[model samples]
Target: MGRRRSAVLTVLIALVAIYSLVPLAWLVVNATKTQEGLLSSFGLWFDDGRFALFDNVRQTLTYDDGVFVRWLGNTLLYVVAGAGGATLLATLGGYGLAKFDFPGKRAVFAVVIGAVAVPGTALAVPTFLMFSRMGLTNTPWSVIIPSLVSPFGLYLMWTFSQQAVPDEMLEAARIDGAGEFHTFFRVSAPLLGPGIVTVLLFTVVATWNNYFLPLIMLKDPQWYPLTIGLNSWNDQAQTVGGQAVFNLVITGSLLTILPLLAAFLLLQRYWQSGLAAGSVKE
Candidate 1:
C-alpha cells in the first residue's frame, strides 16, 4: 500500500512540474530561433539555420534609438530610490510605533492599517492630481514619491518590531545611558535585520513591477522602465510586419527576469533567517 501511494504521488508531482515548466521551456526554445525559424519551423525544437543571438541583443539595444538602455537605467533608479526609501521609512515608523508610547499613537496605527487596506491603483488618480498641482508630473518624482509610501511595508515592519524586538533589551540600553535614537540604532536596528531585509525585498519587487502609476505619470519614453518598454515593443510588433521583434520581446523578457532572480538568490539567506528569527523568538 505504501509503495502504491508513493508511486501515485510521484506521478502527480511530475505532472505539476511539467505544467509549471512548459511555458519556460517554450520561452527558451523560442528565444533561440530567428524570426523566420519561429514562423516556419516547429517552435519547441531548434532549426537547421542559426541567427546570432548577439545580433538580436544588439538590435534590441540599438532599436528605437537605443531607448531600451534608458529604460533599464530608469528601472534601476526607481528600485533603488523608491524601494530603498520606503524600506527606511517603514523601518523607522514601525520601530517608533512599537517601542514608544505617545499621544495619538493608536490613531496613527489605525490610519496606517487603513492605508494598507486601500489599493494603490485607487489612489493613483488622486496622487496624479496632487502632483500635477505641484507641477511634478512627467518626472521621476511622480513615480518615486508614490512608491516610497508603502503601507504594507510599514505594517510588516510594525509586526516584525513588536515580535522580534524585546522590551528587556530596550530597558537595558536605557539603563546604560543610551538615548532613544541611539538605542534604536545600536540595539534595536541590529536585531531587526531580518525585518529590514524583508521590507527591502518586498519594496524592490513592487517598485520593479509598477506600471499604472508610471504610465499615468510619465509621458516621456526616455523615462520608461522595462515593463513599459517591452509593452511598447509588443504594441509596435503588429505594425512592423516581418520584423523579428517577437524574438526581441522574448529575449527582453528573459533579461528583465535575470536581475530579479539574482536579487532573490542573494537575499534568500536573509529572508530565511528573518523567518526563523521571528518564529524562534516569539
Candidate 2:
C-alpha cells in the first residue's frame, strides 16, 4: 500500500509539472518560428525549414525605428527607480515601526496596515487625478512615483523586521554611542540584508509587471515600458498590415521575461536567507 501510494503521488507530481510547463514550452517553441511558420505549424511543435529566432530578434529591435529598445530602457529605469526607492522607504519605515515608540505610532502603523489592505487598482483613479493636478501626468514620474509607495512591501518589511531584527542588539548599539541613524545604517541595515533584498525583488517585479498605471498615466507611446509596448504591438498585430508584428511581439515578450528570471536566480539565496532569518531565535 505504501509503494502504491508513493507511485501515485509521483505520477501526480509529474502530471502537475507537465501541466505547468506545457504553456512555457509552447511559447519557447513558437518564439523560434517565423511569422509564416507561426501561422502554419502546430504551436507546440517546431516547423520545418524555418527557424527565424535570430531574424525575429533583429526585426524586434528594428521595428518602428527600434522603439522596443527604448521601451526596454524605460522599463529598466522605472524598475530601478521605483523598486529601489520603495525598498529603502519600506526598510526605514518598517524598522522604525518595529523598533521605536513615539506619539501616534500605533495610528501610523494602523495606516500602514490599512494601506496594505487597500487594493492598488482601486487607488489608480485618485492617483491619476492627483498627478494630473500636479501637471505630472503623461510623464515617467507619473508611473514611477506611484510605484515607490508599495504598501505590501512596507508590510513585508515590518513583519521581517519584527522577526529578523532583535531589540537587544539595537539597544547594545545605542549604548555603544552609535547615533540612531548611524546605528540603523551601520548595524541594522546589514542585519536586514535578506529582508531588503526580498523586498527589492518583490518591488522590482511589481513595477516591471505594472501595466494599468502606465496605461492610464502615459499618453506617449515613446514613454511606454515593455508591458505597454508589447500591448501596443498586440493591438497593431490584429490589423492586416501589422500581421508580421505578431512574431516580434512574442519574441519581445520572451526577452522581457529573461531579466526577471535572472533576478530571481541571482537573489534567490537572499530570499531563502530571509525565510530562515525570520524563523531564527534571537
Estimate the TM-score of every prediction: 0.89, 0.92
Clashes (N, CA, C under 3 Å) per candidate: 0, 0
**Model 1, TM vs. native:** 0.89
Cα deviation at 105, candidate 2, in Å, is 2.0
Model 1 Cα lDDT, one tens digit per residue, 1-282: 999999999999999999988877777777777888878878677767895466667877887788888999999999999999999999999988888899998899899999999999999999999999999999999999999998998999998899778999999989999999999889888789988988899999999999999989988988988998898888877674836588788777777877887899988888787677767664
- Model 1 steric clash pairs: none
lDDT of 2: 0.90
- In model 2, state the lDDT of residue 209: 96
Task: Report the lDDT tens digits of candidate 2 across residue range 1-282.
Answer: 999999999999999999989978887888899999988999989989678988989999998899999999999999989989999999998888888878998888889889989988999999999999999999999998998898888888888888677888888999999999998989788778888998889898999999999999999999999999999999999998989799998899889998998999989987787567656644
Clashes of 2: 0
Candidate 2, which segments miss by more than 4 Å at Cα?
A: 1-16, 273-282
